[model samples]
Target: MVDRNSPIPIYYQLKLHFKQQMKSGLLQPGDRLPTEMKLCRQLGISRAPVRQALTELAREGFIYRRPGQGTFVAPESAARLSQRTTIRILTYYDVLWMASLEQAVHHWNFSHPEQEVDLTVTMCPRSEFHQVLRRAVAKGEAPDMVPLDYVWITNYARAGYIVPLDTLDALWTRILREDLEPVVAHHNTVDGKLYGLPTQADVTGMWYRRDWFAKEGLTPPETWDAWLALLDHFSSPGMRQRWGHRYAGAFPIGTAAGEATLNLLLPFVWVAGGELLDEKGNLALDTPALRRALRFLQQITLERRAALPPQMASYRWWNICRLLGRGITPMTLGGTYEWPRIREESEWTDEADAVAHLGFVPVPRPSLDAPPVSSLGGTSWVILQQSPAREVCLEILKLVVLPENLAAFCGDGLQISAYRSLNRRLATTPEHPWLAKVIPLLSLARSRPLLSDYPQVSRFLQKMLEQVLWVGAPLEETVRQTAQALALLLEY
Candidate 1:
């Protein structure tokens, strides 16, 4: 029915009409929505309102469109249409490890069939996440819950897009406080409010081929000097020819912006004792430690005689892992997140083959006396401010964070769970011997600054690295300029 005389906007009116139909069960799952042309004719209105209504509905999870096919009622929406309470979740998907997350949701659904839930999984690039989420929020279509990178929580919280869980339930809060790893607990608490729940944790390190090391009669390097020597040894021209590989190591210092490159580099800065910001909350890039780290990187990367190839300047972080797996590079700076993929793709298919050939270690120290450092990695689950079902969302989050479920999810993804008890349990299991090596490294793990401007700051660091490695910019000048940019970004 066209409300020609009503003061409400045509699109709003049309949206209400369709929503009422859906809520009343007039529309069922798999039911096709009318085409824009048909909707226009049926409502006696122009295509503009019809299109707007459809777009909003789609964003709200009322419907979905399949390529080369028509729009259909979303299964989750159809099931939830008549329910008194419904909670919606938005999550990211990557072919590598998203299956565990889905499995968790399935477990929840199976255990709680009376509850209605809708999940929207997006596989968009990480760079586009904020944009997509912001648009949905602006359109009044934000989901009840979402999984966010720990670094993004501060920004979202500051902007009022998400709510602090501290005031929700004292018992639940205490459970999280007791179970979450200290590093993750600290990261999720922004300005004294707990805004997100840590789901997993990761520690960055190096993956090398054990067989190659043994063939060369060498052991994994334990110090920075030894590491450099090892890189040079494997990259020798004779060794390259003999091994039939072109690159000795893969270190992603690509000019293209990505979180992976930043993650791979941050630990180096920490080990050198370089901080992105100082006690005054100002940029602190131009330091002796940073200079030392960059020079070493230049020696191993940008120099013509270096072990790593020049083309590494264009490779993404995962590309380095793939190269290592394919044996194109004997070693690569990577983390446990890529372990499953490497195991699946490498020639080592059995445990004996794997232990004899493939291996990993904490990023080497500057010297035997210096301590090793690993950058803390992984994400947290956030409840948005716009969520109508806050209580329900909290319950769902609790289920997701249960120690057993968290362990399963993190173990499957080859990640470190943020639960200290779960990690301690994994450390005891002989089946995953790598966990013993990795769990100890978590003590040395450092998190990136949870500032609202960190994304910009990280990009600035990447740009500075690219300038030194690719553009041949003067190290001191480039770092000074980058520090200035970081200060300006943080100022506003």
Candidate 2:
């Protein structure tokens, strides 16, 4: 009964068909099922999906294969399914969220002794997580759960690789929807259904040396003009001699920086009143605001010579933080998530010392009357459709998102909680000074465009920025061509 035209893969459909048969008692324990060749012929499909279906069935404890005989139903398969389930998970940067998962697993096993579940976790490199995950899904070997970037949620949801939470448990989904922050909720929902649960939140902004700013009788820039004025002052021979600084400021502006380039620069477009998509979800990249933003960046880096052009293109995302921490630059663009690393690199004695020396601000606007802007960035937990233990995975996620667990994770990571209630608590908590400082700015944060093709779109935007600021290409034509390329990409 596999639908060839359905978004779901044929192998998955075949697996579901056999699973239904077993559940309905049509295929009982010790019953031999059809061979792979026979099933392919009967289902009018190729042998690859049939073989994959059988492989998954065996792995999920639903069926058993003999060396020379044939495949048969697993003995007491239905009765044993819940008792001996092992959920597999894939994650990266196994830090705060991974610890929470471990705790959730322990709690689940302790509370539900009759239905204890084991866990198998695989850690991947952060830079290659998305590509590796996509390959796994394509091969029908996806893990049961993954901590996915919020922007990529739509891609997985639309491709039928992940199931909608509402379809599995509507009540739990409704409760989660009501509990998440509005922006976080917006990023996790695709086509009116929630698909992922965010674990933490972060905002992109600039980090400046508070001590140095005060010493120079200067404040954080409030407008683009003021920002350029500060850069001009800092880049002068007198200021460099006085402060022993090497650069006026720094931020990533090259393709090598990857998504970090967008994290740091997209706010400029927002502050200029530019959007990547219109209200109706059409491409809106070719705008005066974008051109203005790009021109400003080009003027500072290429024309004015405040930030070195060749160095800017070669800098990694974390290099800016390192420059700021080492007192090499007066100011640098970064995210709140980098606080711990920055603090460590600076060798600040403690949180109080770090706060006394450092100051964080949203990206400055184009004019005095304009509002500052920031981009929201975070990771969320999502269940893959290939998971045979969706219910069990949901149970673990529920425990992971408990108020105390979320607080602990965000507190240790120095990140904002996606839950508004916890954020309110963090705002008043004195021990978490960094969170208290940045929580108020959450209102100014906006998520990047949530599209299945966002990875490609982001690449185009990165290339466009590099083309102008680093490669010295004409700004208008570059932006226009990139916009056209993006439109064509989305068209098909």
- Candidate 2, 105: how far from true, in Å? 3.6
Highest-TM-score candidate: 1
Model 1: per-residue lDDT, tens digit, 1-492? 567444234565676677677767788778998898898687676665566567657655678898779998877564554543445656543333333444455456656777755455444555676778889899999988777877788889999999899878877787777777888888888887889887777777888888888888988877778888888887788998888777877777765536777787777777777886789876788888888888877777667445666677776555675677668888888776766546434544333455677777878767767778888777777888888888777776777777777666665445677788888888888775666667777888888877777777777788888888667899989988887777778778
Q: Give the per-residue lDDT of model 2 (tens digit) for 1-492.
A: 887544334565676678778867788999999898898688776665577568657755678899999999988765543355688888764233555676577577658878878666666655677888889988999999998878889988998988899998999889888988899999999999999988888888888899999988999987888888888889899988998889988888888777889878999999988998898998798899888888887778787665443487867666676678778888888887776446434656345766788888999888977787899988888999998889889988999899987886677556788889999999899998877898888898998988888888988998888888888999888988998899999999
Distance (Å) between predicted and true CA of 134, model 1?
2.0
Compute each candidate's TM-score over C-alphas: 0.78, 0.77
Q: Name the lDDT of candidate 2.
A: 0.80
- RMSD (Cα, Å) of model 2: 15.3
Decoy 2 TM-score against native: 0.77
